[model samples]
Target: MNQHILNVKRRTSLVTVFTLILSVQLGFIAYSGELKSRVPPDQLQEAQSLKNPYSVTKEFVDKGRILYEGRAFCSVCHGRDGQGLPVGPDYDSSSQPLPTNFTDGAWQTARSDGEIFWILKNGSHGTDMAAFMPQYVSEKEAWQLVTYLRSFQGA
Candidate 1:
């Protein structure tokens, strides 16, 4: 082959390899957490049955608000108001088919405090809401956010 043709072929090969690698990376990133909820029915029910020892006081709610917006990084997707925000199906998204609106009075009433706590601790599968483990957010703090979410229902 002419030298020019050989160079062109080499460049084409490199481009093909790069494209393949990029596609694979994007695919892996997309499927990394393509689950909706890993919590089993029984386990979820069990978590739902649990309760928060801390009372829903203003102080507790305020602390939770701080954590939600700051340390826990909940507000980015869930919004400062605790209503779900619409983000793409990309990494760090709530996988919120819709912004999981906590502001909904009926939805708020439907879910239990324990259920909320469980989701926070274990994380909702397939969603960008990763598990806020004790290492990241302590058990007490998790409950505090739950308290805030519950109390913030009407607003």
Candidate 2:
């Protein structure tokens, strides 16, 4: 009878330890917010603006070039002209999942800046486009890329 009670106590202790470890891991995931998909709506709108708030002289297109070449490496797949390369899907190809042709005026006109920013940060999953961008890019930088992409519209 004593042996049976001791075995039950040992099993209880092991379960308690396992529960504690699982709770800690779950708490960490909740604190980090890794499970969330979209940015807050207010922040998304502010980040979507096409003009720089700091200075009248700086445009988003100009800043976007710096980001494209430097941090984002956007040119690797999209090309300098924003006419996407074969590294990903061709925007114009019938056989491929059409990427957004930055050069398409009608398409650009239809999309809001917020929509574009969402795509950039979240990426289109299940496609060749792995989320190439990180949320670490400043809101200013995101707007800049928006402007730069607009430049290709109707070009």
What is the model-wide C-alpha lDDT for candidate 1? 0.76
Candidate 1 lDDT, 1-155, residue by residue in tens: 69999999999999999999999998886654333234667697687779888777889888988898898888787788767776555744443444467787866766788877887788776555678877688999998888878766788
Whole-model Cα lDDT per candidate?
A: 0.76, 0.65
Q: Candidate 1: lDDT of 42? A: 65
Q: Give per-residue CA lDDT, model 2, range 1-155, as digits (tens).
A: 99999999999999999999999988986644422323455665664553434442355478888887677877776777777665444454433444455676666766666666766766755455545456547666766776677778788
Compared with the true structure, model 2 gives a TM-score of 0.53
On TM-score, the candidate that comes out on top is 1
Q: TM-scores for all candidates? A: 0.65, 0.53
Query: Considering summed lDDT, which 10 consecutive residues are worst modelled in model 1?
Result: 30-39
Task: Give the poorly placed runs of model 2, Cα more than 4 Å off.
Answer: 1-59, 86-98, 132-136
